[model samples]
Target: MRFDYSEFSGDQGFLSPDELFAPPNLMNFILQYGEQAMDAMANLEDEEEQAFIQQLIDAGLLEESTDEDGNRRLKMSPRLLRGLQHRALLEVFAEMKQGAKEGHSTREPGRTSERSDGTRPYRFGDPIGELDLPGSLQNAARRQVHRAVEEAREAGVEVPRGLRLPIGITPEDFQLHNTEGSADCATVMLIDLSGSMMRYGRFLQAKRVALGMSELIRGRFPLDTLQFVGFSSLAETLHERDLPLVMPKPVSIRDSQVRLRIPLEQAYANQEKIPLHFTNLQLGLRQARQILSRSGAANKQIFIVTDGQPTAHVTTHPATREDMLYLVYPPSDESSELTLREALRCQQRGIRIASFALMEDYWGMDWVGFIEKLTRLTRGTAFYCTSEDLASTVVESYLTGKKSKKFIH
Candidate 1:
């Protein structure tokens, strides 16, 4: 018996260039199918769809640009990108009223000007001013009493019910005035680029969320840093401007079980040799941790949007003590273990983790369990939802984390 294979071809002949779903609309069509929208537009001839192109020009959202091949193509203005980004977030806010009871709507941030009743614990780089003397003394007194009670118990002595005043304040007990929006944050958003994400329009929702988050951080949380890391067989940093063009890697290999170890240097040199559809969350979290370490923000957090458990991870080769990619299929326990270890490392660095698990599959139990274990180990939050719930869930997580960060430091 002989097997034959040839270059795969897509059936685009029936698809017309003017048969576009989204014509620069910020809502359902463009945000969900940006690549198709662009491709459809690019395929049209110069004289074709003149009215539609004119409309885009009239709206000041479209411009002309030359491709690498020196051919002219339609380009979207920064204004259009800004509009799409802002609209994504606005849609989330709009969903808040409808989905708050779903356990995703967080306490809205910027609720009040200042917290007069309490003082938050001081962090290393907090602004120094009138220290909350009462709050400081209270923390000091609590610590002292706790130590005293422990000592008394160990020595079999009765503890004094009343404690003395004039509690000396230590650095640990120092508290800063609680302000509504005082703390700066560094946020890393890890988006799954696994092949599983290609189903049920999952990647579209993820892209929309990333864009919204990028804009939300830029416009609302100016001091906060937002990084998007996409993970598959490898992890790579994604920028906001290039997000729309990004898509989940199509499954390139089909095997019941797979195991491969590729040298990191070699993989980087010739990336086309390796498959890019397996989830490698350990590398994603590691990238996020490194990016956050460089940020000067007082509060750091990671938001992971993924649809499946990790199937691949990177490990340092014992002999070389250098980076290497460990790929596996059927989601080996080893892969999950390595990913969870990285999550733990993130938590140990005072970074909060929030996992948004997209459960569109009936066979989602394995991934949900992994998410549960991750949250447990990191002392973080987990949200189980579908792609439809992603916008509100992401918004709630972002707002919830932002407001609650006041207590973290």
Candidate 2:
């Protein structure tokens, strides 16, 4: 999963968390000496977490300063925040692997999913998706003029406001698209929150990618929509702000104790609520299919972010005596029933499925096979990204695929 960091530093000129910050951990330094820091630090020893805070500052992810008392402290940089926001946008519709191949209809007179043809006469019961806005307006105006003239003659009097044509569209007056047809496209993001995600320290990264993708779709594709599906035992929709916030570094014993008691520990870890399970790949895919169906788009797609072999399918599933003993450290499954169903469902709807595996170890040959099948079944792509280049790799893959779908000259 290791990647060459240099590959991410070229002309794209996008800033990283490091380039924008002051030298080091401003917050920890501040907490040690400052009086105004938040109460979250009450249980935290000032010097104990200094290194962690410093890492944030050195990475350019945070800014530091002291108040009148001259204490050390930190805050998130505006640049980093804006950059994260942009990343979120990129995540949603980074790239389309394919574009509409079908013809468009103009008769319906509104925006259609595909490329539009020229306009046509008004018709009754045409779909609004194909409506031709400009032509429809013109028809309304034309009808008004004709109605005025006819009324004047029939009434045998100069046309007054009542007799004059006040444009009104009847069933016969409605125009529709002349082209063939079109359909809207949709996508669903499946995030894995099994314990392995925590073990490999990728749970937070997955959340960021998920949020970014959702933001991208919301901003760019007015016609397209994205649904967030977090799967561990089962799948549930998550709000964008609820993404996980796992730190990039390790924690100490005292910190660990605090982490364990937090009412919603996962939420605190990632600064967002994330699902937890024992690597239930099957449950996740089943949830994804249900979510995709709700999108109601003409096309659907699924993206999976995971780092381990799926173990149990449900958080509450019963384990045998031997299996219970194994639960202390479960082996990666050689095959996954969930992945099989995921592939089938995606393929049935022409939905693409992509994977981003962010583990140092491949987990096992079985997991690799599952990843391969997931990609092949839906004809999507996959990437193995380590710590240094995970986000960049995802952005690259997304934008590249999107570019491929554009009708470039």
Candidate 3:
């Protein structure tokens, strides 16, 4: 059941020795291609590679089965999935190590004046006193030289020998010394489990982000709390132990008709029969608020990772026996307003809402407006990014929020 380290120590055709052992790459491939990952492995001509695949099966890392159509498929075992989550967390830690050093201090501008060895692009409102004069000047010089070269190329004029460009010290060229600080914080990651997220593979990306953030908080800020909430037709709190096992349900044409007829509670009760397919953002925010209300941390923040507009909300009606719950769809203005109200409530509670709009460009103006307003109302930030950058973006946002005292109420 154990993997032979020596077999993977040597190169195997298209994959290098290191890649064969890299859990993140292997997990990503399997998540994206499913059975194809195993098929590719099985197709390998090398006996060592074949044995390696067999070991994965023997170790319960992978399960080979047939679908309803009798086609062979490979599924990742729970143990292997958990290992992948750990691997993803490690990758984030590795990225943090390569970036700025971690430590604790007051992020207030006037409270702490000491500067670290690192420098970052100067942000508006950063105290001028914190500026790194030498680094800023160098940045300005580089910009000026690049501009001069472009001007010469446009004019069809050869650069004069020994030409010296004057350094322009614009604010845009300023650089500030990086600072590190820490604060007690409670963060809830609201992941969109709607059909669209699964359709585009964004759900998997978000899952990895959650795992990475969980690890970051657990390792770096031991006292801080990080909660994960997944929202589709309804919002549910997910424990860290169950995170690796979560999978998005595929959306079929009949999903819309079937999900709308069922109550949210009933759907949840029969989750295996009726999978979540609609985006219920309002429910997610409400749950986040409830979770954060119990936390004593000075800083409370909500990080939303979504790929589409809010398309559903919860409503109740009195029935003959009891009150019935329903999921309202088409993302009406009421739903949008309710979602905003929840965000405003969070703000009033001193909770900052930072949203990462994955695939925003592909979803059009409605998605853009929703995310922009959510962040603006809460006085938080919004980032539009691709799936490839989601993990790094989530980690950076969390770290920045922790270091900056402004996010604290």
**RMSD in order of candidates:** 15.1, 13.0, 15.0
Give the alpha carbon lDDT tens digit for every residue of 1-409 in model 2. Answer: 1113666546669756434433224323332222333223333467856665566556666567776877655455544444554544444334323442212222343544444556676555556766667677667777777778887889999765542345576545556666534445576677775555655446645655655665555564557676766655334566544342322122212221111111222333453333344455665666677777677676676767777666544222256312110111243343265456656876786676767766566445356666676666666777766633455455445433431211111
lDDT of 1 by residue, 87-139 (tens): 77776777664534322122332222344445677778766664687778889
Q: Which pairs clash inside model 1?
A: none
* Decreasing lDDT order of the candidates: 1, 3, 2
Worst lDDT 10-window in candidate 3: 400-409
Tens digit of per-residue lDDT, candidate 3, span 299-343:
888988888777676555556443233444555676677788888
Tell me the TM-score of model 2.
0.48
Q: Estimate the lDDT of model 1.
A: 0.76
What are the lDDT scores of the predictions, listed in order?
0.76, 0.52, 0.71
Candidate 3 colliding pairs = 105-181
What's model 2's overall lDDT?
A: 0.52
Q: Candidate 2 vs candidate 3: which has greater TM-score? A: 3
- For candidate 1, report its TM-score: 0.72
